[model samples]
Target: MNTNEEHEPRIEVTAPLGERYDEMLSAGALGFLADLHDRFASRRHDLLAERMRRRVEIANGRDPQFMPETAWIRQDLTWRVAGAAPGLEDRRVEITGPTDRKMSINALNSGARVWLADQEDATSPTWANVVEGQLSLHDAICGILSFTSAEGKEYRVTAERTPTIVMRPRGWHLAEKHLHFVDRQGRSLPASGSLVDFGLYFWHNAQRLVDAGRGPYFYLPKIESHEEARLWNDVFVFAQQRIGMPRGTVRATVLIETLPAAFQMEEILYQLREHCAGLNAGRWDYLFSIIKTYRSRGSEYVLPDRTQLTMTTPFMRAYTELLVATCHRRGAYAIGGMSAFIPNRRDPEVTERAFAKVTDDKRREAGDGFDGTWVAHPDLIPIAQAEFDAVLGERPNQLERTRDDMHVTASDLLAFKGAGGEVTLAGVRDDIAVTLRYVESWLRGVGAAAIDNLMEDAATAEIARSQLWQWIENETVTAEGERIDVELVHRLRDEVLGQLPRTASDRFDDAVKVLEQVALRPEYPAFLTVMAYTRYLGETPTTESTTQPETPAQPKSAREHARLVGERDELPIAV
Candidate 1:
């Protein structure tokens, strides 16, 4: 336990402190995180509640439109976000991965202009991972991060020009249960994961990074509204002031990944103008958000196979073009989404096809006026960079190429007609298998996995399971005229399980159970990870008593607590 100011609350560490964890979780850092929670946690809660309320409105047939109230902000064409921070001015290629020590070093040395060290969808939030990720960033900044594989392959940061580091913290809806803070009324609350990640990173490395000619940059993820973007802007302001740094030192790139956010791209950038660097077309999660937002509307909004929904699709094109037009109009870079293809050295045909697809995707983004794009693995960085290079020969970015001809409307954004592909029994089986495998891996503290040569993360699983749920709910008829139903899904699941090797039977079975609980329910869970977290990662505190003590008894250790809870009986499968 660490105490802050006499009037301020103290933070209790319920997780076992590991090597270097103490260095990152010092008293001052904890105090800073606590301050952020005390000030903004409630607002975060309210914003999430508003998300649910807005979902209800959409369910009642209120199609999302650009806000009339924010028309003044959108119409003000003279305003622009702050110019790019040091080392961020030329982000023609950026690589993304978790901030494990090895990954931190490799990404920094990946030759891309920026490395998106992720703590969100690409990371599984085990307690160790959360704390160690912060430590990895700290070390990477100090130029001491390295790794050695089992075969004695030593990896280090050898790039003469390393990528600028931009951290992506967790979203607002999640809480850092490992860290506890007391509120004014003597009620204990979980610290916002967003604050814990941002506060610790900024507190320890802001000055260091600034002195190194780069500052503490970020990628704000899973935001739904300009108000949410405003919340982050305020956070950056307070954190900079709290640490005695300049107000604009913390730069952020917002991911316009939600359906509502697609409509408010300009508004989001406007809200974070002073701190905004750019916006990313977070394409995968954007797809999941579309399905989740319109799940109840009817069959018209239901999406097709995730494989079929390319960036060139009408709705997707509308979203990307609108993003580029909005961003470049405001003097901010419009980054394209991730190209989740990992090269296979042993299979030249697979590698060649993947490279061709990556080349086409990057070429499309570059030609469409995007400043840069994301690559999952280092091997694909050169492929993406070459395309961007050909388009942007001398210029660092295409911010000047504002696509004014892109006249996207609400209908264009929501146009899913002709995009649906054949949904077969094989598709159903694949979805079940991928969703189950992903959930199982997520529970075991792995967030990014390569399944069938595609890098599948939380967003991929979200799309997989959400498609199944949407198809079943709509009784969507497949290409063979087989309508999706609970019985059909079950048959597919069983058939997939039967084909699995005996060694993986138990794990696959548990995954099936989890998929049923989340995807097959009468109502869709907002996030599959949230449900999986409660069931496997950490236990939720009791909501029965209102007048209880501010801080509950501490758990012996986070690992032990997780073990006990994970052993609890699994949720019963829906019949």
Candidate 2:
């Protein structure tokens, strides 16, 4: 490990370094990260504690309404966020993917206006991925990224029309255990994943990006409140000042994913006004947050199957419409949610139907005045762009179309009562199937899975598992009059495991164990990835030694893997 002899606070990397890892983790970068930790880590802790306190209040029937204290911020309409920084003006379509080498090239060349190079939901936080993803982003920024497949097909970033690169760091809830920082008490604490990602990226490439006519743009994920937005804004300020750049050089677009965040869109944008780009309607995580927040409220709050919860539902409509109006009112862009459909290569009919659905989804967003939309796959890019183009035409955006007709009350946002379609046996099976498969892929170091022609990520798994827990907790009866109890879930789980394809049996078995533990428990875990990280992926500090065990004495389930790591600690009891 390399360290600066003169710096007081040094970054001690517990993870093994890989090729080019040193370049990204230099003393200067690590020192910047440590400085961020020292300045803001305690505030991050307090904010997380605030999140828990709020959740408890909600559990005690304290409904979330617009904060009366921040009423003036919302009522006042003269303020607007800073205008778009370089390379962020015309974001009609943005493609999102992990920052692996090939994906970096494909997404940048995908013809979308912006590429959300994701280190968050779309990436498994393996140590190698954490380090290598930064390397990929750096290479892409310098226009030196290229890849040759094992079959010898070369891929490179096209020189013509490359999309603007906007990095999405991990959320504030997570910690980077691989990077340790010593506190004043001489004790070690995990570095904030958010800081590590943002600090490293900013330290390495902020100037280069600015020199290349783009600023260091980001997509802030999983923020629950405006204070969280304030934390990010403060980080942006410190980072720019530390690196000797302008104050608003770092622009960020916050993802309105959590239900609480949906209610505070204006406040969030207000807090980050100088550094804000806009807001994104993160459809899947938003649903997961709703279910998680209100799971104990009985059937009125119980969501139906994951498949039935479309964006057109009354509650979802209220959320999105309010977001568009809020953004336009504040003079910011309103970006739509992801269309997760991946075209089926073999079946033209399936591809056509999927494209049609995507077209409708994007058209609705365009007509409702969204400046842009998100697509997971390259093929869907043109489909989404065409819809946005039909609405945008020669204009860069439709910020002039202020959606004054929309007014979303708290009750309308909470009107999930019977809005989603009825739960059914097929939905139960699908929930189990998709959750298991997704968890399996995640264990194998893949975060995004193309399951059944849809791009399923961590959010998809969260919604699926949350649905199971909600159903079982509420004793929700399926359309066939079968109660979704623990027994039925276990039965379906075993049956699904039995039906798994031969090649995937071992991984599928591991996935079933994970799904059962998370979904069938008496209390719902806040996030499955958090627990799974402490279990399977936390074995080794780095990816070099942490690849799956070659020969195991027992079945390599996530639980077994945890045991292999000598971690026998009981799962934390949910509050």
Candidate 3:
């Protein structure tokens, strides 16, 4: 524990302390978290408020476009991000998975170039998961991470080549209710999940990573605007300084998942240029954001089946094109989205089709000048790598081909009419079934699950539920001429639930309640996980209250953050 911890905000652990939890929730680590919250909590509040304000503007019929105020940053092409840090330069095949022990070993032993240690959408933040996930990373870095099944089978990282690890923390909007922080004025607040995840990972491993010839690298998720990006940059600066590391020792790749972010890609990159490595195409979450943002507008924003809106769709194509162009122009890496096709070992035909689809997706990305792409299963790594190798033989990346020839506009991005497909009864049923199964699994403390031979996480659930709500709001009619309404959704929900197994331990009933609340309600919840977290997982408090609340408590301002500048200040950072 740090000797100076008494002066920091006091951290209270609300959950039952399990085995080895103390190692992660040490006094020094909690002190680091408290300092982070003290410095950035107010700005986080301001940014979230800005997000709500922007959403209201969009709902008032103002379409998102390139901002007029930040044109100078976009017009200036001379600035480049502090390009790829050590162990991150030659990333051609990246595998993304939750940070479970077995999955972590499999991912590291896989021949992928990088492993995205996902703690965000790919992880359900049960108390055990939140603590043990940190333990997994700590052990993995120490080269002792392993797992043993009940049947005596063991899994370990023994491959000749291991992938570099890049951690993805939870987004800014989520709160970690298992932990709380008391400010100097004695106001208790829910801990910011982003701060706790990033602070623990960085505090425990920053020096160790530097010793291993790598730095603390990260993938930032769910950023909606450049101002949020600026907040991240500020946090990175403060964190490195707090750890006594160099100003630019940390590297981050922002996930351009939201629709507003796509319009400000250049500005997002420019804000984090000192620590930015690249931008990733979070395809599923991008679709979810589109539905959530424009769900109230009209039929034009109402999409077809989720299967119909593939990466080749016009709007998706525009998003990716602009991403690659902006990244290459600014000397940053352009990574592709995940292909969530999990292979079936028992069926040869199923595996063959999975390989073909993944190959086609990777082939398109490689042909379009992407630096790398993501795969869910290790079995598909070689397939993705082969496609990228065919395009980039002996070359680390195709950074030289800037692709300045391709130009995309806001109209191209909002071209929902180009995705012409009729919504079908089968599509609605599939969404219902998938959402139910995934939500049940999530409530059971599993974030990543194989459903219908595809690896799915919270992003998939978000898309599914948002589509249901949007279809109901727009009174969408299926190809069979059946109007999608509350009755239809409720009936289909029952039908899907009837088909699912009802074991004694199943949480299907709770899942149904969640589905009804998020999908069948008049007001769309910003995130389904927030509702589930508060209602199910966030019942415990330091004062011994076990009763669940219907909604999450709003964050309160603690104090003002003082801007810190070092010897390497080129621009003033907004705090």
Question: Model 1, 1-575: lDDT tens per residue?
Answer: 33332445656688778777889999988888878877887788778777876776777678899899999988888999995989999999999999888888889888999999999998888887898898889889999888888999998888898899999999876767788877654557667788888888999999999999999999999999999999999999999998799888889999999999998998999999999999999999999999877776778777777777889888999999999999999999999998767789888988998899999999999999999999998999999999999999989998878877878898899887657576776777778888987887777777888878889999989889988988887888887789998899988888877876657423565577679866775545678776666555643322214312233344474322222232111221111
Clashes per model (N, Cα, C within 3 A): 0, 0, 0
- Report each candidate's C-alpha RMSD, comma-separated, in the order given: 7.1, 6.2, 6.9
Tens digit of lDDT per residue, candidate 2, span 82-143? Answer: 85888999999999999989889999888889999999999989898899999999999888
Assess candidate 1 and give its lDDT: 0.83
Full-model lDDT for every candidate:
0.83, 0.85, 0.86
TM-score of 3: 0.93
lDDT of 3: 0.86
Better of 1 and 3 by TM-score: 3
Q: Tell me model 2's lDDT, rounded to 2 decimals.
A: 0.85
Off by over 4 Å in 3: 1-8, 538-575
Query: Quick one: ranking by lDDT, best first?
Result: 3, 2, 1
Q: Kindly indicate the candidate among 1 and 2 with the higher lDDT.
A: 2
What lDDT does candidate 3 reach at residue 226?
94
Give per-model TM-scores. Answer: 0.91, 0.92, 0.93
